[model samples]
Target: MSSSTLFSPLTFGDFKIPHRVVMAPMTRSRSAQPGNVPTESMATYYAQRAGAAFIVSEATQITPQGQGYSFTPGIYSAEQVAGWRGVTDAVHAAGGRMVLQLWHVGRMSHPVFQQGQAPVAPSALAPNAQVWIVDEHGQGGMVDCPVPRALTVSEIRAIVNDYYTAAANALAAGFDGVEIHAANGYLIDSFLRSGSNLRTDAYGGSIEKRLRFLDEVTDAVVDAVGAARVGVRLSPHITQRGMHCPDMIVTTLKAARRLSDKGIAYLHFAEADWDDAPPVPESFRRDVRRAFGGAIGVAGGYTEARAQAVIRAGWADWVAFGRPFIANPDLPARLRNHLPLTVPDTHTLFGGDERGYTDYPNAG
Candidate 1:
C-alpha cells in the first residue's frame, strides 16, 4: 500500500486487479516444438510474478497463417491448449489472473515461416522491416519482408473462424479472458490503417469500411467467449516497420466508438513506444474513455510517476508494465516497498536463457 498511486486496486475486464501494475504481452518467442506450445519454463516464468494484478500472455497466433514470427506461441491446437493449461494453472496457483493475447502478423510475416506459403494482408503491400526466418535448426535468419498477398473476401471470413477457434482455446486453457491483438502493425492494424489498406473491397474504403475487418474479428471472439472477457490492444502512434497510423486521434476515437457498440470488456490503447514516436495527448484517452464507456488501459514507456499521474487524473483504469516486469520479476513487491528497479538486459530479450527472464532480485 506504499505506492505513489500505482498500487491501488482497479477493475480490469472480469477480474478485480489487486494492483494496477499489469505484465504486458511481450513476445519472448520461446515456445517449444510442433505448434509453438508453451513449455513448463514459460509457466514458471509467469507464476513467479503472480503478484501482478493481471498478466497478458505473449502474442499467441490464432492459426498457422496468423504467425508472423517464428517461435511465437499459438493457442489453436490441442497440444498448444494443453501447454497453456500448464501456464494458467501456475498463475492461478500463485493467485494471479492471466489473459491470452491472440495475434496474426499479416504482412509482417514472411512466406518462409508459413510452411512455404505466401504471407497475406488486406493489400499486397509489404511492411518496411525485416522478418526473422527460422532455419532447420530454429535459428533466426533476418530477411527482407515479402509483399503479402491480398486477402480475398472468402479468406477474410476464414480468418474470422480462426479468432473463434483461438477464443475457445483460451477458455479451454483456463484463461480468465482473451485480448485481441488488433494494434501494433499486425493484421488488424493493417486493415484499420489507411496507409496499408488500399483495397476497394467493403473492408477497405472509408474509415467505417476500414473498420469492418476488426469489428468482425471482435464479434467472433466475443461470440466465442463472452464480451465481458474480451479486450483489444491498439497502438495508435507506434509506426512499426513501415506501418503508420498517422491520424491516430481520428482513428483511435472512431475505433473506440466502433468497439463501443460491441459492449466488449476493455480497450488497451498503446500510444507510442519509440523515442521519436509522437506523444499521445491526455485528450485522446479522455476521448476514448468518453466514446467507449467500458474500461480503458493505457501503455507505452510510462514510468511509475507518470502511470500514477494518469490514473490519478482518471485517464486510465490500468497501466501495463513491460520492461520493468522483464528485469524485475518481483515488480509488484518492488513498487509496494519503493525499491529501485533493475535495469533490463537487452541482449536476452527475445530468445535466451533464464538469466534475464527470472533472475532479477526485488530487494536486498
Candidate 2:
C-alpha cells in the first residue's frame, strides 16, 4: 500500500472514502445525440476509471435551457435519468462512487442551442468565449457567444427550482451525491462576479446581493437532497471569458463561509489549469480553510507529486485530477506504484467514440 497522504482515507460526513485522489469533472461531449442522453459507452468509460476515490461526472445540464455545448448530457429528462442510472450502476458495481455535476452555461452560449432565443444571464453581457457547436451536417467547431438577455427575478427563482429538481433527479439516477457547478463563468458564477452581473436588483450589485442566487440554489439543492450529499464548486482565480472581478476572492471566501454555514459536504476549487496560469496562492487556500470547515478539494493540472504535496501541506483534504485520469484508468494504482502515465490524445479529448475514451488500457 502507498504511504502517501493521497492514499489516505478521508471522510465527507457519511462518505468515508478510501483515498484522497478524486476524479474531477470534465466535459467530454460524447453523449448520445438528439436527446443528449448518457450512453452505454459513457458507463464503460466511467467504470474504467472506478479506481478514483469518487468520480464527479461531466457537467450535466439541469434543464434544456442549461445546455451550451453539443452532445453534453442532461439530467432533466426521464430518458437522461434512466441513461445515467446505467452509468451509476456500472460505477457502483465496479466498487466506486460518483456524483453528478449540475451545470448551466448562462452567457457562455449561442442562440443555436437556445432555440434562436438569446441565452440568459444575470445581465446582458457577452462572455467573449466560444463554445463547441455541432452543425446540422455533424461537423463541430467553436462558435462565438452573443450577448445574453438578463434573467428576471422570477426566472432566477425558476432556475433555483430547476437545480432542486436536478438534484433530486440525480439521486433517482443512483448517484452518490451532486455538485453544483457554480464555477467557470457559468450562470451562478456570473451572478457572483460584478463584471457579468451588473443587475441592480436583489441578485446583484453588492457582494452580498451577488451571492443570493448561489445561496438560494444551494438551499434548494440541500433541501431537495441533504447537506451531506451536496458540494459546491467555485473558481476565484479564473479571469478568462471576462470573469475577472476585483472582489472575486473576497466574494468566494464569503460564499465559502455561507456554504459552510449551510453545512454542505465540501467546497471544490476549479483552479485555472493553463500552462501560463497564475498559481493558486497558499494564503488563499488557508483563508478558505478557515472559512469552510468541511472537506476541501481542488482540481487543476495536478501530478501525483503535486497532489501529495498539497495534501501534506494541510490545505486540502483531497486532490482532484482531470487530464491525467483521461489516459490512466487505473490512476490511483499507477500513482501508488509509481508507474508511468499514458498521455491522452488531445484531438480525441472531446466528442468521439471509444478510440480515446475507453480504449486506453489499464496498467497490468
Candidate 3:
C-alpha cells in the first residue's frame, strides 16, 4: 500500500490507461455561443491536461429541455456535435482519452435560463439551495428555485429518449464514451432521492421503482454507445442539492449491485461532498470494490497521499482530483515531481476568462 500505485496503469474495458489519475467532470460553463458548443480554447484547455488516464468533460445537457444553465455544452444538435468533434480530436491529438458527461438538471434550472420555460422534475418540489440564474448575456443572478412541474409518464419516456438521442449524438461526435450524470441531484438523482420524489407511480415510491429512471437511461445509453464505452457517474450517500435517503448505503447497494451485473466500463462514484461530505470510511469503499470488480474511480477533496492510499488499498482503481487539477493543470507531473501547488482563485471559480481556466502554471 504505497502512494506510487496511484500512477499505475489500470484497464477499463477496452481502454488501458497508463496511469490511475483521472480528471473529474468539472462545470467550466465556457462553451461558445448558440447551443453552448465546445470552442477551440476549451480544446486547448483539455489537451493541456491530457496526462490524465481519463478525462470526463463538464456536464453536457441532452437538449434545450435538459439544459439548466447558460454557456454549458450540449450534445443534442448537429452543430453541438460538430463543436465537440474539435475537442475530441484535440484530446486524441494530445494522446488523451475523454468521455462526454450526459446530464439533465431537472429542478435545478430557472425559467430565466430556459427561455422562460418552467423547469420539470419527478415532483413539484423545490431545491433547498438557490441556483445561479443566467441572463441572455450570461450574467449571473441569484434566485430561489421555483416549484417544478411533475412530468407525466409520456414526458418521462420522452426524456429517456432525449438521453438516448444525446448518447447517439455523442458517439457521432467522436467521443471515446459517455458518462451518465446520475448524481448531484440532477434529473436522475432527483428521482432517486426520496426527499425529491414523492410520487406513487411505477417510477417512484419504493426503492426498486425509484431506481427505474436511472436504470432505463443507463440501458438506453449502453444500447446506443455500447456498455464498454458507457460509464456512470453517481454520488452515493452524499447530500448534494438536498439529497437525502432513508438508508443511503442500503439503497445505493441494492440499486448499484444490479448495475454492476450489467457490465459498465466503470463507475465514477462521488462518495461524499466537496466540503462537508463525510470521509469514505474504509468499509464503504471496500464494499463497493468487492461488489463490482470493474474499474471504480473515486473523486472529492483528496491529496496525492489519499489518492494513492485508496489505490494501494485496492479500494479504487483510479482517483479524480477536482480543485487541485483546476489550479495545477499539470497535476500528475506535479505529483510525480513533488512540485509546488497554487491555491485556486475562489472568485474566478465560475464565470471567467482564461485567467483561471487554461492559464494554470505547468510543472516546468
Candidate 4:
C-alpha cells in the first residue's frame, strides 16, 4: 500500500471521510431533455464511482435562468428533485456521501436559453465566452455569449432566494450537503471581479461591495441548510473567458475570511488546470489557509504525488479529481492499488449516452 497522506482519514464537517480523494463536480450534459432532469444513467454513473471518499456532483442549475450549457440538470422543480433523489439514493446505497453543486451561469447564457431575453449580470458586460448549446435539430456546438443586461437590485435579491430554495431542494433530494458554485467566470465570480462587475450600485465599486452578493447568497443557503452543510467553490487564479481581474486574489482571500466567519464546512478552489495554465502561487495558498480555518479542497491537474505534497504541507485538506474519475469509476481503489487508469474518450465527454458514461470496467 502507498504510504501517502492522500490515504489518510480526516474529519470534514458533518462526515468523517476515509481518504483525501474527492470526486470533483464535472458537467457531462446528459440530463433528460425538455425539463433538464437527472436520468437513471446518471445514477448508475455516480454509483459506479462510489468508492471515492466523497463526491461533489455535477453543477446543477438553481433555476432555468442559471443554465448555460445544453442538457445540464437542475434542482428547481419537484420532478427534478425526485430525479436527483434517485441518484443520491444510489450513491448512498453504494456507501458514498455526495453533495449537490448549486450553479447560476449568469451572463454565460445565450438568448436561446433565456427565452429571447438578454442574460443578466452585475453589469451589462459580455465575457466574450462561448457555452455549449444544442439546437432544435439536436446538434450541439459552442455559441458566443452576447452582452448581458444589468440586474436590478431586487432581481439580485430574488436570485439569492433562488439559491436558498435550491439548497433546500438538494437536502430534500437526499444530498449530504450543497456546494455553492461561486467559481469560474459564472455569476458569482463575475460579481467578485472588477473587470466584469462595473456596477456603481451597492453591489459593486469597492471589493466589499462586489462581495455583498456572494455574502447574501451564502447566508441564504446557510439559513436554508445549516453552515456545516454548506461549502463554497472559488476560482481566484482562473483568468479565462474575460475574467481577468487584477485584484482577484485579494478579493478571493477576503471572501474566504468571510466564509470562515460564517462557519461554513469547506472552501474549494478551482485552479486553472490546463497544461499551459499559470500555477497557483504557494504564497497565495498559504494566505488562503490562514484566511479559512475550515477544510480546504483544491481541483486542477493533481496527481497522487502532487496531492500528497499539498496535503502534507497543510495547504489543502483534500484533492478533487475531475477528468480522471470520468473513465475510472473505481478511482480511489485504482489509485490505492497503483493501477493504470482508463483514458476517457474525448468525443463522449459531454452530451452522450452510456457508451462512455458507465461502460468503463474496474481493474479487477
Task: Report lDDT (Cα) of residue 260, candidate 4.
Answer: 96
Better of 1 and 2 by lDDT: 2
C-alpha local distance difference test of each model: 0.85, 0.93, 0.84, 0.93
Candidate 4: residue 195 Cα off by (Å): 0.2
Clashing pairs in 2: none
lDDT of 4 by residue, 1-364 (tens): 2343889998867867999999999999999978999999999999999888899999999999999999999999999999999999999999999999999999999998899999989999999999999888988999999999999999999999999999999999999999999989999999999999999999999999999999999999999999998999999888888999999989999999999999999999998888988778899999998999899999999988888889888899899999999989989988888999889999998898999999998887
**Candidate 3 TM-score versus the reference:** 0.95
Off by over 4 Å in 2: 1-4
The TM-score obtained by model 2 is 0.98
Q: For candidate 3, write residues 73-175 as lDDT tens digits.
A: 8898888899899989999999999999999999998886667777999999888767765676757766777888899999999989999999999989888
Candidate 4: worst 10 consecutive residues by lDDT? 1-10
Task: Flag regions of model 4 displaced more than 4 Å.
Answer: 1-4
The per-candidate count of clashes, in order, stands at 0, 0, 0, 0
For model 1, how does the per-residue alpha-carbon lDDT over 64-129 read when each residue is reduced to its tens digit?
A: 888887788988888999999999999999999999999998988887677787799999888887
lDDT score for residue 243 of model 1 = 71
